[model samples]
Target: MKIAICCRKGSFSDYWLTYCEENGISYKKVDAYQSDIMKQIEDCDAFMWHFSHLDYKDKVFAKQLLYSIEASGKPVFPNFKTVWHFDDKLGQKYLFESIKAPLVTSYAFYTKQEALLWANKASFPKVFKLRGGAGSTNVKLVDTRKEAVSLISRAFSRGFSAYDPLASLKDRWRDYRSGKCPFFVLLKSFFRLFIVSSAIKLLPLEKGYVYFQDFIPNNDTDTRIVVIGDKIIGERRGVRNGDFRASGSHILLPDASKVDMRCVQLAYNVSQKLGLQIGVFDFVHDKDNPLLVEVSYGTDPDYTECEGYWNEKLQFTSAPINLPKMIIESFIQNSSN
Candidate 1:
């Protein structure tokens, strides 16, 4: 059997190529962007691509291509359910609720008047977020009815750009202070502040609709649990000073004990039910109740401090696990069976 991989210079593809080569797995590197991508993949049984959220061209059609390939009967890593909500929190709001998952109370409005009306009656300190973004980059805290109203006006007016240079600078500073990044990283972030808009802005303003979540107070950290097949790796990201968002706290560890078992149970159950090959779920809690924040298909494992992993049966092991290899092998095994 042969497989085709959508090759990029860096990213998971690097590990994929190395694994396939070492295992004597027959594979070809194919570009999923070209006009003849369909014909190009005709010779392979599966395709894999670590499509990114920061690429303009990729944002435009990566999922479309992946879906098309799946529709054509070839397997893909992010087959529909796994990816349809990749960068879209709005879509996820509906999905989580539909699945009866314990998502933080959230509201979405498609009109300014509706948003304003809700703002009048809604409580303060709601967490405002754009539909797409990671690391708490676009997440904001709306502390009062007035603040919510003002945001509603702006959201419906020229709309808000998905990219915030000033926020980027603050994040860089936070990482530096936390010793997670260096001085040069701050310099790069400063330079990027003036260079140009991020590819995320190609998304346009998130006007016409506003989304807010009930802020869970005193949440100093958020738990991140990643599940691939039966292996699970999890982390806890501490929030920045006085901030409620934890996804980009510049801290991570793989100590499962630090994570609430309830959250892990929710992530594992939901991901398994969805038939997701992989899922990285964010969560925070109130007292002992863990609440889900968001879910994604990817996370940077390089810096994570996972001491071990858990299996589908909830058994823990101290052995170092290989996610990229697991991803590729699953495709092969699923096909043969």
Candidate 2:
């Protein structure tokens, strides 16, 4: 079967293409940006592109291309269900609620009056997040009503940038200071201060609505479990020093013991119920129980988690698993069947 792998340089597609070559699977590297992209895949049975949240151009058109292809009965890597809510926290909130999944309690307001009304009466220490972005880049803590009210005004006014330069700088410094990054990495941040990339500059501000979730306190880390077909991979991320957020806290190593087995089961069930083929669901807990924080199609460092995996039966397999291969092969398998 012929496949078209959207080749974003150095991305999962790189390995996907390599795997195809190594295994003698028929494939072609296609640039999804080309206007004739549809024509590019005419002879292909499937397409696999790992579209990201940062690219404005990508956010605007990646799914459009994929869904359009899907309408033609061609199989896509994310398919429809796997990526319907990618990079959209607001969409995820409702999907979880609709599915009766154990998502962290979240609220959103689209109107100035509505947001202000909620802000005035709502409790503080809520987790404020822009609908887009990964790595906790858009997530923050709203500790007071006044702070929340100000946020609402901006949400209705000019809005927030999906990329926050100051926040980015702070995160870089934090990572460096925490020994999470080397000295050269810190220099890169300084360079970034003056020379921001086109991707950041091109992204328009995020507005139209504001979303907040109850800040589940005492969570020093967040657990991420990735389910690829019937196989699952898990990891725990320790929060930054004195920080309650763990979603982007770069200090994580694969440790099966640190994960709550219940989370594994819940992830399996939720993904199954949603008809999801591949997903990475994040979880954080209060004192008593674990709460779902977020879900996404891909994690920035999903490859770093070359560790343990679990099958659908809750059986553990401590061998190395290549998730990117699984993701690509799943698309091909579905198409062939």
- Candidate that would win on lDDT: 2
Tens digits of per-residue lDDT for model 1, 138-181: 89988889888888898888887777888989888988887887
- What is the TM-score of each predicted model, taking all chains together? 0.95, 0.96
Candidate 1 local lDDT, residue 326: 66
lDDT of 2 by residue, 160-244 (tens): 9778877777887888888887878778777887888988888988888999999898877788888877888888888899677
Residue 184 accuracy (lDDT) in model 2: 83
lDDT value for candidate 1?
0.82
lDDT of each: 0.82, 0.84
Query: Clashing residue pairs, candidate 2?
Result: none
Which segments of model 2 are wrong by more than 4 Å? 301-306
**Which candidate number maximizes TM-score?**
2
